[model samples]
Target: MLVVAGAMAETSLVAFRGWPSEALEFYEGLTADNSKTYWTAHLTVYETQVREPMTELLAALEPEFGPGKIFRPYRDVRFSKDKSPYKTHLGAWLEAGGYIQLSADGLAAGSGMYQMASDQLDRYRRAVADDRAGRELTTVIEAIEQARIHVQGHGSLKTVPRGYPKDHPRLDLLRHKGLVTWQEWAPAAWLGTAAARNRIVDFLRTSRPLRRWLDENVGPSTVQR
Candidate 1:
């Protein structure tokens, strides 16, 4: 049962029924035919078969991880050259700092900063340079990787930033522009079962130490979003 305590009366908790097989099929079809006519014809399937289950999954995650906002299906084509009509995947972000996505390829979850503003990057570099904090982060990253999940940065400088020692002990840390934890689940039988949610919950839980390290050492950007 996908019951979140205090969410509502006991009777109101929605049991998460995993995404149906048709959810992937819908995306597969959309990928091939992204025309508005195709979307209009299949709109009902997208809502009932794909969106509903995802909404339930997010609701279930809300009790522990906080509320999540689903991404709008409409694509922003004004600035893009490709000008695709819709996104190939569905995505959402939780207020508590987590992301989820579903598509024909698979489901994915991620957390941590994808990219930091200039000010935040400066602070992050300072923390990474701190001997004790840097070592602690190394341990956290190692543990997460040992669990078979990936820990990586958004973009890394070819070399250490200026003013940082060329031979610094945490050389790799100083080169990072941003840091994040990510995991993906390719289409599988388990994905259609509650195990999908379990795997995500496990990944997020395992990555908690890394998130905590960031919170303590490199918090939210002081710069406006």
Candidate 2:
């Protein structure tokens, strides 16, 4: 939905009512028949029910979080063994640093560097090893957890990386290859309403401390993937 107040377009905002139930149904069908035939048959459903609402939501969120880019629905099967042609979910990344996804499982929101380059990993380990920065991170993670959001370490090592020993105080932090704060909500009635946006907004706001820690300490990876 759009509103035009006058000839001079003062504001052009697309209304985001949230994803309809059809969006989930589309994914459910795709999960069963993951082929071009299924996608081609349901292209209308994908564009209107899934993609449009997501674009509106991103637009609404951009005022505070900066621009958000939706991920391509097609899966990259070049290196993968499964070889699925399409992704099971729709996701977007906010430039300010956050993520949102919708799928058959429901909605998920997260913010962090999912994977780090070697240099970034090295910096992350060093920060975690330092008593002051490490303790601060621990506190941040604890608070986020208490809020019922999980802080995850992507590709965490079974043992603390190569150094810092078995008796290291911040062993758990050092083992993390990447850090992210994530929250998931199972499918429900609220998913088809604006409440969905509210939930993601809360998650992005709650992750501020964690984002600050990473930005101030680890920063971005210098090594190109």
> Which tens-of-lDDT digit does each residue in 84-197 have in candidate 2?
899999999999999999999999999988888999999999999898999999999999999999999998999978868788988887888989999999999999998999
Model 2 segments more than 4 A misplaced: 1-13
Worst 10 residues of 2 by lDDT: 1-10
- TM per candidate comes to 0.92, 0.94
Identify the candidate with maximal lDDT. Answer: 2
- What is residue 212's positional error in candidate 2, in angstroms? 0.7
Clashes of 1: 0
Q: Each model's RMSD to truth, in Å?
A: 3.3, 2.5
| Candidate 1 structure quality by residue, lDDT tens digits, 1-225 | 346555555535466667888999999999999879988999998998788878888888998889999999989999999777988898988877888999999999998888889888888899888888889989999999999999988799999999899999989888999898999888989888778889888988888888888877788777866
lDDT of 1 at 40: 94
Worst 10 residues of 1 by lDDT: 2-11
